[model samples]
Target: MSELPVLIYDGDCGFCTRSVRWAERLPVRMRILAWQEADLAAYRTTPERARHEVLWVAPSGRVFGGAAAVAELLRSARLPWPVVGWAMSAPVLRWVAERVYRWVADNRSRLPGATPACQLPPEQRPGHRHGS
Candidate 1:
C-alpha cells in the first residue's frame, strides 16, 4: 500500500522538520515526510502554493489545508488530539483557528530556520521519533 497520507512540509524549516520527525514516530505507524525533499508532483501543488501552507493528500485524492489538514492528520493517527479536533469544527473554534492560521502564516518566517512553523516542545510533542 502507498502509506498513510503524506504531509508535505518544508524540510529546511526547523519547525517543519521537527514536526514531521515527531509525526514519524506517532503510534499510528505511517509515513509522514517533508515534501520539499520528496517528489510529490503527484500531489500536484505549485511550489509557490505549498510554501505558504501545510498539506495533506488522502488516499482518495482528497486534499486539505491549514487547520483542516491538522485535524485530519490527528484523526488519521487516531490521536487523542482529535478530541479537541472535533471541537474545532464548532464555529467559534473555527474562527479562532482561522485567526491562528493567519498568525502562523504571517509569522512562519520568524521561526527557527526561518521556516513558517515550529516543533512543539519535546515533552508535549509525540513520542515515537523522540522515544517515549
Candidate 2:
C-alpha cells in the first residue's frame, strides 16, 4: 500500500541488482521490490507473468511492461535521463525498443542467475537448478 511507484526486478541477478541500485539513487522518491521479496500472491501478476519481464507500477496505478517499464525507469531518473524516457515513449522510438526488449528476453537466462550454460528445450532440460 505504499503510495510511491514500484520497480520489480530479479533479486538474485547481480547485474539486475546493480541496475536497480542505480535507479534507487535517482532523485525521485520511489519504491523497489525484488521479485523474490515481493509478496505477489494476491496480485493478478501470475508467476509466469512475473518471471518473464520487469514491471513498473506507477503511483497513479499505471503498470508498464517491457520497454515501457524501462522508460518509466528512465523517467524516474534525475534529468537528462528523463528525456530518454520521454523520447522512448514516442511511436517510432518504441518500435525499436520493442525489438531490443525481445532480444534481451530471448537471452535473459544468460544474463545472470543459476542455470546450465543456456536454457534447454523441453527435450533437453538444462538439469541445473539455476535459471534467469
Candidate 3:
C-alpha cells in the first residue's frame, strides 16, 4: 500500500487531542501526530501555523490547513465520508465549511472536552492582525 498522509494537531489543546482520538476510530489509516511530537520541517509546516489550525500533510509534502485539512482528511476515509468530503470541497460548501471551521477553532476552548490549554494565544487566534 502507499504511504498514508500525516495529520498534525495541537497536543496541548484538549479539544484538539480529543478530536484526534475521534479520528483514530475511523476505518482509514493515516498518521495522526501531535505537532509537538512531529518534525514540522519534515511536513513543510511551522509551529505557528500548526498551532493556529489543524493540518493535513500529503506524502508529497503538500499541506492543507483548517477546513481544507478537514476535507482532505474526510476524503481519505471510508464510504459515505468521502462523499461528505467531496461536498465540503465543493465551491459553496467549501466557503461555508471554512467559516465554520474558523468559528470552531476560535472558540474551541469553550467547547466540550476542552481544557484551559485549548485557548489559543490571542495572537494565534483567527482575525488577529499583526502589529495591531
State in Å the error of residue 27, model 3. Answer: 1.0
Which candidate number would show the highest TM-score if scored against the true structure?
Answer: 3
RMSD of each candidate relative to the true structure: 9.2, 4.8, 5.2
lDDT of 1 at 40: 54
Instruction: Report the Cα lDDT for candidate 1.
Output: 0.62
TM per prediction: 0.71, 0.75, 0.87
Q: Which tens-of-lDDT digit does each residue in 1-132 have in candidate 2?
A: 458878887655555566678777778677788765666553335435555677887877677877899898898887798999989889999999878886876675577542542354422432212332
Instruction: Estimate the lDDT of model 3.
Output: 0.84
Candidate 1, superposed: residue stretches over 4 Å from native: 1-3, 112-132
List model 3 lDDT by residue over 71-116, tens digit each.
Answer: 9998999988899899999999999999999999989999899886
1 or 2, greater by TM-score:
2
**Model 1 Cα lDDT, one tens digit per residue, 52-124:** 6777777666767777776667676665766766766578887887678768755665755553234433233
Q: After superposition, how far is residue 35 of candidate 2 from its true place, in Å?
A: 1.1
Candidate 3: pairs in clash: none
